[model samples]
Target: SLPAAAIHRGAPGPSVPESPGAAAAAGSLFRPLSAEDGEQRPAEIESLCMNCFRNGVTRLLLTRIPFFKEIIVSSFACDSCSWSNTEIQSAGRIQEQGVRYTLAITSRQDMNREVVKTDCATARIPELDFEIPAFTQKGVLTTIEGIIDRAVAGLEQDQPIRRVTDEEVASKIDEFIGKLKQLKEVHSPFTFIIDDPSGNSFVENPHAPQKDDALVVTHYRRTPQQAAMLGLEVMGSCCSVVSPLHVLQFNTNCPECNAPANTNMKLVQIPHFKEVIIMATNCDSCGHRTNEVKSGGAIEPQGTRITLQITDPSDMTRDILKSETCSVEIPELEFELGMGALGGKFTTLEGLLKDIRDLVERNPFTLGDSSTPGKTEKLQEFIGKLNEIIEGKTKAHFIMDDPAGNSYLQNVYAPEEDPELKVERYERTFEQNEDLGLNDMKTEGYESEGASGR
Candidate 1:
């Protein structure tokens, strides 16, 4: 599979939104190229064509998409056989996480949107129940229509042979091909998905710098198998892997009963964004088990405040990555989980709420002479309200304020706006910086400072 390409270099160009209204939404981002822009020649290299064993030329264009990163698009053509090929390669390094792009195709205009399918990317049409496996046909830089056309061509190519040998299978193939062809007309809406472990695939959005209702993009941590595919994971010594992904175990005392225990500490990468160290301890004497998550990176420069409105029970299933320095707040329930209350956690929204209830009930201050009947009743009422939110019986806003900017709250409705979610990033206040001990930290000129002060 050598990471080959499927885009035909002979394509005049990608289909663009032609309707005036669609063009308006596209703005300068998707505007047609001017003569001056077309005058610029791309870099070229002459090479042997694998098809005809004749000399061919490959042209490379380096361009940056609006509201997106830079990329290189290469087109190759062999004059002898008139064979053409096109490929797209990401100019940036491998991202921290793999990405999944889901696009809802409901109209002809939608089919014109450009797509980048890397060699390691898998494309699927859920409505058709058909999938294009990675490296099956090579990477491609084409439009939604282009991908479907390619599928149609591949299916029809095998029908002739099937009709001669296996008429039964051939008839089924013909029927399936007919259904795939109808999709081109978009008689019914269908989902187009591209899951790329390399995080190199892309689906264009005419409405750039704004949310697209029909598209959703989610970032996910790569599994060991996926990492191995990308050459990021290797066998041999456990230490062969990079930091924040290694396992370390040591002896420790159990917190529950002060008994001897062995704590398993593994610094692992989390799906939300970064790496976190997870510690689990077991006490054989008391049969006690406990696990905890701890931050493994330095404090972020800016602070993050994420607000998610819980309007549906399904929202409870949303993933939440709460860093050690984050605080959870529910104004409607008049409840707040202060910083360091639950330490660091990677769990679902409902799970976090449940933990909050348990932590409050177990608060040492809730016991002794300080605990009054009135206080107990109030606490019980609050817990009940928390349960309602978790059950989606009541609507509420879940807020996480992290001065370290490492926390994350999943948006089930992504690549599009989730009316229920709003996020804001702000500079940390002086007091907040002091609390995180960032004021005393020196990141820049440390060598010079050491030389001078020492």
Candidate 2:
């Protein structure tokens, strides 16, 4: 039997206003839940067993959260299967924008601060190269120490770390874990970042900061890519059509032909890099096909450059994911791949060369009666050189310059000992950032060379 005041079936109730303190707190904000009868309700429903198909009773408790607003806490238990589950949902309207919280943990006191993380939040400790992606765990009301412990647990179960056979690498990981545990008691400084595209996460901010200091909270509009990843409506005329498995499809005109073409875009999450939207387009009328890759995350503060040499045939198999803002260059051949020249693509070095070869073969500058003998000879020579590189008959350098830091080159089994393959990363210039849309062109910023303070 439930309380009569607690059960409200289908009626309009008075709206409960939020408190000032609740609105100021850097935690979850929610409005009170009321039914048409002016009373809150706790609904009960059937819960199906995940392992076995047995059904059990699920009780949903709707109540006002202490110091917050209202939330629904649901619990379920199966007597036959001995299974249990619990979940929480905020009784508030969805926020229009996402939030990013950055806290610099300098003292043990900072480690004990409360943290409220939603299921849509992604936590990252950049100093340790550790990350917990969205939906890794349910929303949790825990302290900073608890978050670190969860990260440690996730790292222990990581398949890639477990697959590493190098004794030194394994020892390094163990040392990192030990250091993370020590941060709870020790005063080691580190940065803790939580990004939530759903705008449902929060960090307990008891006292408001007066000056620019450690704990910095910033709210940013979700990029089109990030919005798509979170299954939110994009802010544009393009209507997103939901397909199977959360894929988004939309209609677009083919660049080669005027016919209508269907573009399929999906969000791809990479380990080290940020989320990316992979779009594949095809036109049946003109046989035009194109694949484009765009970063679905924030613009990186710094840029990245990857340089690799193709010495053997096996090097051609190395994977490369180039973002639309990235440019490719082969210094040895005096060939440069400008931005948007071939569009963004995810392919092997061999496949990329093949694509370039095909582009050269199809270019009007190389073929047709308008071409001269010298131009034709030069094009043929370049094609021959590309073929040589593909066949491992000659060596060539592959350079990728990405100001957005979204491009990636496989480095798991890379020959770091070889001097031929050089990889370097440096800060991008203000102009470069402006060109990449990272900063406004009119904004004033300090100019720098290869490495200098901004």
Candidate 3:
């Protein structure tokens, strides 16, 4: 069947055929016609719907878009299944590079600015550590606030799973939703970023006398990875996997035993936070296995500190999601767990202590004959302390200091009036921010003081 654009529309009856030269000129105009010429030669074509396998109708309307010169607006509807689809395609030739749009949403008015996002565009809110990868949703023409609202809906849809597994994470997701809503109210400041590898997305730029300081537009060549992800590397080929989230497997040599291994990497979405890549590697030759978690999104703004008291056996069951940036401390034992100590993990307090114990046991000095008596005694003492805590035979302080505020400790069941269990959130100091390579973070107008201890 002919496409809707192929069907001709003119003066009510059967249309008179134009000369071959005129048809060739019309085809040329579709590539690069000036706004004036496009307006002078408006075209509309309609045909039976091919989509829905129904005899309904479809229309192709060629019009001059405001900023964009010429575009084809296609619409289709089928009464049989009530199926409908609408898409806009640029008539201009495709560009060789991609475009990126960054808008600083500082006021409520900014939220109302028009935004055009293609299906191949990835949207990000760095401050919120939230991102919507390409192919996650269909192309849309909406406002900044509308995009944020859609993201909120997506996060909300995943709340049930988070609530059952980790209520702390669930509560954090709620906080993030509130922050997004606050942006709609102009109560907070955030940056909105959109990268379209197809160079088809756009953000409205109202030409005002005073240029808007809030908007930044840039164009650049797509990286090889971006090109491959968008299926642009091959001219006429499409990606085998259309979804942005998928498992990837690769072969590698194990770090521990230097044996051949296979690694499976999966993208995991954490409610309220950025997506994470969870990688698990197994060496069949030596039965060696390892796992790691890496963030797939942006770094957090402020820092977080969670302090909990291990007073009873029930406290050992509390879940914790510790980010790689977090530093765990047990002041009672004079022990500290830095980044890469246990890698990033989601485990209970008891499980965390057990992991620490295992690491201590693996230390060369712990089992070496050349080890000094004092060193061995200290290691044994730390192990005994961990065991005591896990057995609920002793009470101790558990502290987690994360400069990115990505780590979490469950506190859903904490007593409201208890002074022992606490969660403290603070602004990252200059040194801390520098250490995290977040020197350009916008901290102006944000509270410099630490949040009152909870």
Candidate 4:
């Protein structure tokens, strides 16, 4: 199918329409289009109607949404059968990150907020366990209530025929239709979410001038399958297997200055732990150095959580392998280091603490002049306590949670269990698996499945 776009009618008009290979390479949706831009009107073209086999008209408008992206809104109408349809598509590029929008609906007014759902986006009502799968419906520019109304209309459209063909099926559909209608009543609260791997879907914020406490937006890395679906990856590409050499060195370009640089990769196996790949990049022009560690094995069957009580200063000397997927938390201080915050690192507990302190102190959000004095003062207090913890003056608990079960902390007593350390393995949650893209990953019989498809 062609890339998705916004349809002007059947709901609320869409202000933005972006799609895979169709989203604007560089533009902000918030920018307003000036009158001088001179937008073009829709062009009418005679076309055949598939439903009636009669002459129909398709009006297509190719225009940009303000200063945003270019979109094509098309509407087809056939006077003979009184049939009409509408959809929108974009001519821009796919976004680098996937986006998800979650809104809490509490009142009738909330349903009126505008929404843009690309053909590749998935819409869901978590409370009702109802989902509109991707590609099931064409891209739409509608409000929350508009979506429900359209769904109700579609179900009723086939009821008359179903009742004559299969009475039982019609009755079941009628019952489901009733439940769908009740969703718009707003009797209680419910969450409506749109997940678009293409990064083109949008949900308007009701409180535009102010932050909407009821709405949350999340951006995440796309899975390889999603990239393939967007035609970002070439089919039947080369395998990822690398050379067997223990260490490999190559030249590269510096990210900062685009100057000459060198990178080194080495395979290292930690004692009592699995193997890992360590990469170090150095730029002579900029005098910049970076080191990263990556887990070199398949995901384990279960997640692992490790907790260690920090009592003496020597505890900070312990070696720790913190993978990119591992999250660190200091419960007593209420400090947390989210996964991927520090990338992957192989360092001592003291070194990890120093890195955390540096990240906190150097954070742009907290260091700018726009920051509040109260917040800065509180941060200073937290840093003082962190220093005490590092010096063994404060007793605290250090916890590492890894969904991949790849992170590790050294045990001073070789075969004996450390009194201060506790390890627990548990099954990962469905949401966690979704974030990791494991739910849609197919690795076992994929080759055979692809062959069958062929």
On TM-score, the leading prediction is: 4
TM-score of 3: 0.41
Alpha carbon lDDT of each predicted model: 0.72, 0.66, 0.66, 0.74
Which ranking of candidates, highest TM-score first? 4, 1, 2, 3
Error of model 3, residue 417, in angstroms: 10
Could you give candidate 4's per-residue lDDT for residues 246-342 as a string of tens digits? 5788887654334568889988888888888888988875576888888888888899999999998999999999988898988788776756557
Please report the TM-score between candidate 1 and the true structure.
Answer: 0.46
Query: Can you write out model 1's per-residue Cα lDDT over 1-454, one digit (the tens) per residue?
Result: 1112322432222223347565346432222222345443555789989989999998765544321233556788988999877776655446546778889999988997767788788999987789999878766667788898888889898787899999999999899989988988998899999999887777865542124679877655577799888878545555443355466778986554345689888877755467767788888866878777766676677999999878889999998888767888888865666565566787899888888877666442242123457656766777778888888899998899998888888877775777899989899998778666667766799799889998
- Give candidate 4's total backbone clashes: 8
lDDT tens digits, residue span 1-454, model 3 = 0122322331121111256566444442233223333234333344566655657665555543333334555556676877666665554434446777888888777886667777778999898788999888776656788788888888898899999999999999999888877778877788899998877777754321113467776555566788887656555654653224677888887644344689988877654345667788988755768777666566666788889988888889877778777888888886766543466777788888887787666433242332357757766776777899999999999999988777767764443434556777788888677556567557674554444432
Q: How do the residues 49-104 of candidate 2 rate in per-residue lDDT, one tens digit apiece?
A: 77577997776665543322345556666778877665656554345457778888
Scored against the true structure, residue 256 in model 2 reaches a CA lDDT of 42
> Model 4 scores what on Cα lDDT?
0.74
CA shift of 410, model 3, Å: 2.6
Report the candidate with higher TM-score, 2 versus 4: 4
Alpha-carbon lDDT of model 1: 0.72
Top lDDT hit? 4
Worst 10 residues of 1 by lDDT: 1-10
